[model samples]
Target: MNALYNCISKYYPITSEAWKALSNALTQIKIPRNSFLVKEGTVCNNLYFLERGCLRGYYSLDGKEITYWFGFEDNFVTSFYSFISRKPAVENIQALEDSTLWSISYEALHLLFDAHHDLERLVRIINEQYYIRLEERFMAMQFKTAKERYEQLIENSPHILHRISLGQTASYLGISQETLSRIRSQV
Candidate 1:
């Protein structure tokens, strides 16, 4: 769990006492590739920290999976809407590779917040970062063409291509695999 501690320390430092509380709340688990972490129509009860491997968040739309985002090592993975609102999620989070994760239930997190205000602030900051990325993605989708998006993805996260299938990458870019192939060939 040193990796988790290092990641958390980069965001906010917690006292040993607070760390102990958090450690007690976290449950480490392994998810096989293609396993569902958060399924559609289910309430996401836990927030997970990806200790190793990758995951994707997607929606099943008219028989097609529309991937929205991906999470890699060190990423916090969850259905944010469902986790925060306590509502059923419209999207699913699936492991793209065999993954190891540490998770904390919503109830446990809130209890930690009550006992340790620093932990709350740390999560708030992390949520703000997530919101910023969400806004960036929204703006990119609004203004960029598919090719531009593909190019940006290549420039920003080229490692993703190596980790996930091309079809999944195409879905994340809001394009067909054929279209992605064409763009990729031209590049």
Candidate 2:
């Protein structure tokens, strides 16, 4: 739970009292590699904050997984659409590695937010951060070529190419695996 406290502390210091109040509300979740945290068509019930692990969010189309983003330790993971709207998700959130996370259901989070002003602000700030990240990805996809995107990916997270499968990496870059291979060879 140190990670939880530290992560929250970055945005705002959590008092001992606040921590005590939240501790019992958080549930520990163990996610296995290659399985889902949130599946398509299911409403996301929990807001997961990864303590130790990596995860990817993807959409499936024509029987293929098209990953758009990845998240690592000390990061929050969820399907925003499903979470905010209480509707079924169109994306899938899956662990890339075996991970342990701390999670609270939306209902529990709302209750806490209502009770704690700081927590409400923290969630809003975190939401804004996610929105900025999404905007960056969208702009990259809109303006960059496949090779350029692959280059940017390599520049950003060189290990990502090594850690995930070729298909998965290609999908995340919005390119075919063959194109990914070509870009990779040049690098």
Candidate 3:
């Protein structure tokens, strides 16, 4: 939980009371590789913070899986639309490696938000940051070349290369593994 503490503290300080409340709400669990955190068409009822390993968010298109984002250690991962709207998820999140995660149920989170202004602020900030990232990714997908997208992802998330499979990485880049190999060779 040190990772969670450090990450949240880096963003904003919380009172000891707030910290205790959050920790009390967090449940630690281990997820094995190849497991789904949230599957398409299911409602996402929990928000998880990865304490170790990697998770990928993807959705199937015409039976092909296309990855949209990855969550690394100390970062949050969730099917946002499903979690926020209480609707079925359009995306799926899976563990890329065996992982330790801290999770809070939707009810628990709302309770915290209602009880603590600091917690509410934290949630707001997290939401804003996630939205910004989503917009950036959407823009890149619409405007950037495949090679450019690959380069930008490598620049921003160098460690991801070592954490995920080549096929998964290619999927995230929206390219064929062969194309990723060609791009990698050129680099």
Candidate 4:
């Protein structure tokens, strides 16, 4: 949990009391590769901190899985829309590797926010960061060519190719596996 503490400290320092409360709320769980952390049509009840390994968020469309985002170690993982709106999620979150994560239920998190202003502020900042990344991705998809997108992905997150299957990577880029292979060879 040192990793979680370190990450929280980077965002905002909490009182010992708040830390105690948060620690009590966190439950550690391990998910094997290809396991679903969250499935479509379910309400996401917990927010997870990826302590080790990777996860991907995707949606099923026209019988294809379109990956939208990835969560790596030290990142928070959740279906934001479902978690916030109390609605069923349209996206599925799956473990890309054998993973360990610290999870806190929505109720527990809201209780903490009510009790600790610092914790609330920290979460607000984290959400803001998430929104910024989402906007960046939206803009890229709207404006960039597939080649340009692939190049940007290589420049920004080259390690992703090593961590996930090419097919998944291609899906995330909104391209076919064959097209990704062609772009990769040209690059």
Q: Can you give the TM-score per candidate against the true fold? A: 0.97, 0.95, 0.97, 0.97
Q: For model 3, what is the error of residue 180's alpha carbon versus the real structure, in angstroms, after optimal superposition?
A: 1.0
Q: Write one digit per residue (lDDT tens) for candidate 2, span 1-187.
A: 9888889889777567667778889999998998889999999998988999889999999988889989888998899989999999999998999999999999999998888777888889889999998999999999999888888888888878767889888888888999988888887
Q: Tens digit of lDDT per residue, candidate 1, span 82-156?
A: 999999999999998899999999999999999999999989989999999999999888999998998999899
Model 3 / residue 176 / CA error / Å: 1.3
Query: Each candidate: how many clashes?
Result: 0, 0, 0, 0
- The candidate with the higher lDDT, 2 or 4, is 4
* Candidate 4 residue-wise lDDT, 1-187, digit = tens: 9999999898788898889989999999999999999999999999999999999999999998999999999998899999999999999999999999999999999999999888888889889989999999999999999999999999999889899999999998989999999999999
Can you tell me which runs of candidate 2 are displaced by over 4 Å? none
Model 1 regions more than 4 Å off: none
State the weakest 10-residue window (summed lDDT) of model 1. Answer: 168-177
Tens-digit per-residue lDDT, 128-184, candidate 3: 999999999999989999899989989999898888888989988888999999999
Winner of 1 and 3 under lDDT: 1
Name the Cα RMSD for model 4: 0.9
Q: Give candidate 3's error at residue 153 in angstroms.
A: 1.7
- Which candidate order results from sorting by lDDT in descending order? 4, 1, 3, 2
Better of 1 and 2 by lDDT: 1
* TM-score ranking of the models: 1, 4, 3, 2
